[model samples]
Target: MLDAMIDDDHTAVRASTQDGTYPRPQLLRSAWTDLCGTWSFAYDDADEGIASGWSSAGVSERDIVVPFPPESSASGVGDTGMHRVVWYSRDLTTADLAGAGHAAGRRLLLNFGAVDYRCDVWVDGQLAGSHEGGHTPFALDITGSAREGARIVVRAEDDPLDISQPRGKQDWREHPHAIWYHRTTGIWQPVWLESVPAVHITALRWTADPRAGIVTADIELSVRPTTGTEATISLSFDGRELAAVSAVATDRETTVVIPIAELRNGQSYEELLWSPENPRLLDAEVRVGDDVVYSYLGIRTAHVARGRFWLNDRPYYVRSVLNQGYWPESHLAAPSAEALRDEAELIRSLGFNATRVHQKFEDPRFLLAADQLGLLVWGEAPGTYTFTPTAIERTTREWLEVVRRDMSHPSIVTWVPLNESWGVQHIAADPRMQHFARSLVSLTKALDPTRPVVSNDGWEQVDTDVVAIHDYEWRPDVVRQRYATDADIRRLIDSVGPAGRALILSGDVSEAPVMLTEFGGISFDTSAADGAWGYSSATSPDDFAERFEGLMAAVHASEALAGFCYTQLADTLQETNGLVTDERTPKIPVDRIRAAIVGHHAN
Candidate 1:
């Protein structure tokens, strides 16, 4: 595509805000306004816009499509240059959300899905709040700031020199390199306004156990309610209530465990088991006084046992793909929610059970689609490549926040805090690095003990529930010889350090479930493209198929190996190794690739 055709790729982009879909499916509310669409924007090149009183200024001549960042053409401001700071302003009114009606008894709050780096928000000329971290959700109570007509201004700062921010695959250089793409500044996700009762449910957590016939829910309120405020919880399937209970809101948090199995009257129901074949979710509703929220949870279990991934106490093989979560027009921002749903469908159609969201913290809407569509995910943290105390502090804080934000999603099965030693490269030799890796594992387990935590995904093997590796050895014989047996896996890991590669040595690889986390990046450039490369280049389409099939078969035949993750699902800037092109067209029919990988499905 030519530079003149940038808008050609942006056609039919998903307007997430206007789509009326619940941004957070786990917690749904009926009253909200989509603060998306056109907004006034300007660049703060010297970081002097605030000093120049830009926040109080009227809309500028420049208009940027909101939600999409400046780096994306979809935003109408495709400036990929070094942007350290930027400003956005928009207008809203109380009447936009029923000013004196339902909102009169409620508090108006401003919510941001995500903002890259650091951002300060202003509402009606008053400071609302500020948030750090580019990959988590944050909100500000703007009830006091809302008026008949209100002005919202946002000041976002992204320093390429700041090594503390966890920016995944966002190149800090003047231009993109190798696998890195352009950087995103300001809001890369949907911004909206929500109205809630004065005392409402602030958060909800669900943990479902199929074998135990139990599902536990933890509810956090905005405040400790007085005597009259009580929370009523109900569970149902297909709108038929199975259980209902009420608890007084004396404290800010409440825990409720419902016995889902009791509905069967001591009978085993095979359909209750959730899996990729049959993804079932139970409907739940929470009501606190005038506040009502709806959510859902899939009844299932995920664990690692006997050196294999066990789902519902059965061995589950993960045929995953590395989804970088980029777009031709939007870059880091998704074009639409339906587009994300379509992408998930494409991945599932290729017979992949899981996706490793490599480096980037993928949009939550995609995870919501995964939960509804039955695709597993390995949630990873994006971090600075260089190691420092600042990087350590930033990664720890943001990673914990990410876990807190995403732990409710039933699709995510693993928590990968670091990938391929980007931030903590010296973890193999340095004692402090080793301790941090262990601490990350502990922190992940302490918060979300349900999911398996891989200390470092690709090469390093230090205190991890899953021992995964990134081997691009295209030769089938070498892959078979290297990981054919438990003994061979250990030898290959021990040989990694002496061979001048980075592999931290601590726990034995033989004790944990082994997976070829990354492999088979068969580059097939139809355009005979310049700078398009992968682990190996295929001379022809036939060659690509044979090479891909050979590599996949060798790994699948390895009885000692639990699973494998393909290099990628779709190609990104200059990387022609995906199963599909950057335009999202298939390089080869997915049926052929699925047959090559898994041979047959349940059908």
Candidate 2:
């Protein structure tokens, strides 16, 4: 384990590195020794000028855990209710970087899993770099500025009022009652240091086209020198080497394409397609001189055509639940990789083929698990209340980051920009908002021509490819009345039509390919016994079972209905109306839900 320094009062940072290793575990590689662990933390109120200084008094204030935000109880700082600016400082020595045969390089990369809103980083009192956006990961190269043993200080400011930045579900208020929750400030995810050469691979974009039987690898180098550098890319499926190409890296961009057929040696030539049922992945290795980077990707294609969503050209049903990716212990962060995998497996066991990651962007590990486990995903930005020009620009930037990072995963099929008119007031009526929504959809479509883009889900019907709605009326009879007769269903569908709107519903529906995007308000034993539908009351176990049966019966009986996702897989904080408990423990037993969803036994 790597030795770390925190405030004198706090214990040494618990190094998550496995057996003093470096380079750390990426998405596909699952191991216990991966860099995931405890770090020292201190909160600073911007009103007070403690974050800018590095005095002994600033270091002795208090300590919390790293990766996990202060609001979460798991971080040992249970809900301070402080949404103001805060700073975190820690120390790492050269000895910490040296492990086994690995030596500290000239360039030291300080990596942050994620930070909320905006952040500025410093090493040895010198400014390292700064980054914006709350959900995505960013890093800074602190090679020249640091000493043999250096102090790393990070200051982060988050004004949830700043609607320009993408903040998924973080409300500025002290307490969050409805669909929103408390703001998660500074260092919510993991922070670590790595040694990398000055000239190394900064980023790589991997795209696999199974239909064309070709995989295109785009490599981005850190520096473009006068003399070009060559990268040797080795492509392999399973364990056998397919193709090896050494390509010259230009200042702009470099691409290398390899045919799948060339790798198949007398084997049956079947196109490798990634889907909820079958998620096949290929291993890839990129070597720049002696430094090597290993990664994996799945080959799949997704599109919407003729009012049907297709994967690999086959009509695929996206039976999905709205996953906000929040935990009672970690707030917006997942406690562990195991926790992420558990959610994916639970969703699959419940007969859900996909998940709508509502309003929030998820960690890379979550998407990696989904891709490996064969779960389709609908990704979206966090909901906001403002849509100013500045807001649109910032949102567009963050949305692009979301797309760039998650594009390689085959599980992600739909790119959803707006949700339920949270940002667009009167989304249905405001022509400007509607036009902006249409433009966003067009932008997403232009970015990734393969996937379907849903512009404004469940509210304004813009020029998007899919027409989605979120109707959560309580009464079952009323729900049935809206979609019972063809004329009624047609009228409901016609309400949002110029034409070509693939009607997708959140509640009960009687139309073909109708999605129950939201339903099932059954709570667990811990929920309060109120008549309200949210986290307040726990329906009687018998009543809960009855309602589940009734909903399944209604959905299966309607031939027009394609698929439905339960309200949620697990209960989020204050949202007790979930199929599973807050801790991801089953509320009504998994076998029962599986029987209802997969068996299709109508009551």
Candidate 3:
């Protein structure tokens, strides 16, 4: 929100919707203000600004765009250099709080989409609220603090070298290298104010079933559901009510599944098949007493059975791409919600039905776009390379936050707690790491038993529903030579033979649905640079196309592989291996890439 120009090294273009529109599109209200544009910012190198009364004394004379962290070029302060602490202060004028139904008399909820690492908020020099975890959203009720003109100050701190914190794709160096990009230091998401009733709905979750035509919506009321209050939910399509139900209770949480089957029988809705080919969504509205929320649910049934992935109770192929969720300008943040929507639709247009969202708890708006676009997603956490008590604590707390926020989305079919052998690397020999891996799986299951949980993806997959592997065998025959039969796929490849020693690091068994979860990182860019390149670099575009086709053909011919996820959707930072370039331009012909992936030639 830095005025007409944001400080960055790019084209110096402007972004749209820099404001108080609701970030949580899944649960939306019309009354809110966008406080995203500009604010007073200063770098706190000594990290002593808090004790120095920066909150009351006011920030430095520099203007910065809120939510676009200082490290990002789009933030208008492209200082990739580490700043242990940064301060942001905004003057909350009466005009900024003039959203409908949220004027003077209402309790103003100050919402932040995200703030990296640890953050403390102050309203007029008084402690308002604070939140831990970089990816999760938080809100504070600022009723009395909403004067005509008040100073709202936020201080955030992040240390990438501190392995305990979940930094995700944000780099740890002056310049991004390899898989990591520039570190997102402070506020990297939207900040806004909303007016809500004293007793309102706090959270809403939807558990949908496409096969049975039933949607169970769970409502968490801000206060205890009083006897005089009622919670009503309606499922509608094109404004025609398909099913309606209401509940009167006294509990804080109430759950009820509304059957939207045909009037004759309580079975599936044949016309409402939700797939990448035909994305269909059921519009849902919920009202708790006087508080109303507009939301929608995707009713696609996703599960795993018989060593196969099932969609809507039928065997389905997971044509997925590995998406790192980084952009050239915003780093971890998307330029706009429209950019997220366009990215989802673009991936779908390229013929990918699913995506393995790599190493990031992606923006909820992107997931909502996937829910609408019918793209299956494998939700994965950003990998942590070190194992310690601090790491485990942070992982547990933040992982649950991730699950609780996204568990209701029907598009998320699988939850990957860890990637490869990242944090728990010595799992094969380290008992503690093995136990922790198993515990992560158990913790994920305890929260939401609906989706399959992959504890440690790639090699050391201990206690997971999917036996996933990350093998980059360049040749087609070499790939076939490795995984040829069900025995080869199911064999406990650990603590035994050469193949076992090579492939398996810790898992006790591999008797699960086999998915070549990661492979085909063929880099087509021969540009001379110092970027972090891919596994196998391609010489020419024609050679890259041929190699891709041959490798995909090998994967398709293998009956043992339940599914495969291409290395990436687009190039990022130092890595230049993708079906499309970093700018989303197809490296190979889009149709040709699709043909290779689907095992068919384009017409």
Model 2 C-alpha lDDT per residue in residues 1-603, reported as the tens digit of each score = 233212244522211111212222222111112233554555565446343475222354566777778788877777647556776766665455552123455456677778887888877777888998887788788777545547777778887567656776777567775666767877776666655556766676777776667888877666663355777776655455666778766663568887777424334434455677767666676765444565667777777654456777777666678787888788887787677778888888887788888778887777777877888888888866787887777788888887877777778888888876667766655677777777777788776777877766664546555545555544445555655544655676756531233343232233233344565555554555233236324358767777666665555555344445567666666666777777777667778877777645221
Q: What lDDT does candidate 3 reach at residue 20?
A: 15
What Cα-based lDDT does every candidate model obtain? 0.80, 0.65, 0.77
lDDT of 2 at 295: 66
Predictions ranked by TM-score, top down?
Answer: 1, 3, 2
Cand. 2 TM to true fold: 0.86
Q: Give the CA lDDT, 0 to 100, for residue 18 in model 1.
A: 23
Residue 461, model 3: Cα distance from true site in angstroms: 1.1
The 10-residue segment of model 2 with minimum total lDDT is 11-20
Candidate 3, residues 557-600, lDDT tens digits: the string is 77777788989888887788878877788887888877777763
Off by over 4 Å in 2: 1-40, 50-52, 55-58, 99-106, 225-228, 262-271, 475-489, 496-514, 522-525, 529-538, 599-603
Highest lDDT, which number?
A: 1
lDDT of 2: 0.65
What's the true lDDT of residue 596 in model 1? 71
Expressed as tens digits, the lDDT of each residue in 347-405 for candidate 1 is 98888888998887887788878887899999999978778888888899999987887
Each model's Cα RMSD: 5.9, 6.8, 6.0
